[model samples]
Target: MGTQFLTDEKGNKTAVLLPIKKYNKMIEQLEDLHDIKLYDEAKRDDDGTSISIDEAFKIIEEKRKAVK
Candidate 1:
């Protein structure tokens, strides 16, 4: 493994070190997993309600105005 670790005086693993390429790939994979989880949750929460893009935009605009 192209991995290393930073240890404390007590030989405890404090931090990890990985190649920049590996770190980036890990981050991308985590992001993809997060997206999948969100999609699954949304599907589970679905109520069969549908809205057009125009109505969605209008609701967003109303909410933005309320925030200000």
Candidate 2:
């Protein structure tokens, strides 16, 4: 990953320039972290409204069929 900094006329660091690949990788990592946080929050909740894996898969398949 390569990076360069943009500076003001007063030589103060203002912004950064990163390789597109590095920027994309950073975005993916942030998204993954967000997913993990959501999962953790859901796990900590005790409202017993969860469905079984089979039932979940059935619902997903039904939705896919409806879309098609």
> Tens-digit lDDT track for model 2 on 1-68?
57999999999999999999999999999999999999999889948999988999999999999999
- Per-residue alpha-carbon lDDT of candidate 1 for residues 1-68, written as tens digits (9 for 90 to 100): 69999999999999999999999999999999999999899889989896877999999999999999
Model 1 deviation from native, Cα RMSD in Å: 5.1
User: Model 1 segments beyond 4 Å from truth?
Assistant: 51-68
In lDDT terms, how accurate is model 1?
A: 0.96
Clash pairs, candidate 1, are: none
Off by over 4 Å in 2: 57-68
For residue 53, give model 1's deviation from the true position in Å. 7.2
Overall lDDT per candidate, in order of appearance: 0.96, 0.95
Tell me how candidate 2 scores on lDDT: 0.95
